[model samples]
Target: MKHALILVALLGLSVTAVAQTVREPDGYRMDQYRGPVPDSLTGGRVLDPEAAHDLWQAGEAAFIDVLPRAPKPKNLPEGTIWRDKPRHSIPGAIWLPNVGYGAIAEVTADYFRRGLEQATDGNMDHPVVIFCLAECWMSWNAAKRALEYGYSEVYWMPDGTDGWTFFDYPTEVITPEPEP
Candidate 1:
């Protein structure tokens, strides 16, 4: 029992020690003393800002933004809310909203298959990046769905829209696309 306690203590200490070394992109060093990342969900890969940018520029990776709803597009006029993810997407990404807010399970395999079809409409396999509102699970579910669909390269960036903008990547806010 004592050994377990000691191990736990050391584990906590190490996380703190490593966190001190993290640096924000703005040249300001992140504080060494910290708690946990606020509202973080696990089981998905996390990515740094620049890496996200590079993958985007290469076009080898597709970006999908998972949002609940927003102002209707100019054409829609009446506007609409979406339960499944839209296809409008994050520039290169095809929108695929997996789970809604506070969902326990990831999105269904069909959701990913559809997204995969878009990602590989021409290519069978390709690198794909999924994300959602910062500190949200919509992206995690979306990414997992990709894996279930047999995608070899799937990245989940929980940083979401906030993180993307934080790093200053170009984003277009568009109305959701009707699924075909």
Candidate 2:
């Protein structure tokens, strides 16, 4: 019994250690986006569900969802139907897919910039909250980019829609803004 108890405690410790091992990268996460993320972002405020909810209640922040939309495969046979997977996010969030990649094309950068301008009415000082799914790096990248674009008040919600909905916050189906 004593040996079994010691083994269980050691296993618990190992699990805890593993859970604590996610480190923030020096720059954007280039790949493997669906994984643990750091607890904080350097230039932006990291928000939990409750804080995000408060922001939502305040009715000022523009919540931007950066979840990527998968493109239809090019190898599909002619006449094969292709449909984009629908995304549901926090109510009022503007879904700006495909702008969170570590390296983005000039067109994508333009789209992101235009989307932010539209959302904030061209006010760089407007507070903007960027998110995707929990543990997703897309939101981190988007938030970082927003900062680089000179947004003064930027918030990173790493918990994303998963955490928001977990707390029973309402969500709605949203479509991506047209690419610029």
lDDT of 1 by residue, 106-155 (tens): 33344556656676673546776777766554555556555655666767
Clashing pairs in 2: none
* Candidate 2 per-residue C-alpha lDDT over 1-180 given as tens digits, one digit per residue, 9 for 90 to 100: 667557768777554555466777888899988988888877889999899999999997999999999988989998899988889899999999988889999999999999999889999999999999998999998898899989999999999999999999998999999874
- Model 1 local distance difference test score: 0.55
Each candidate's lDDT (Cα)? 0.55, 0.90
**C-alpha positional error of residue 30 in candidate 2 after TM-score superposition, expressed in Å:** 0.7
Give the TM-score (vs. native) of candidate 2. Answer: 0.88
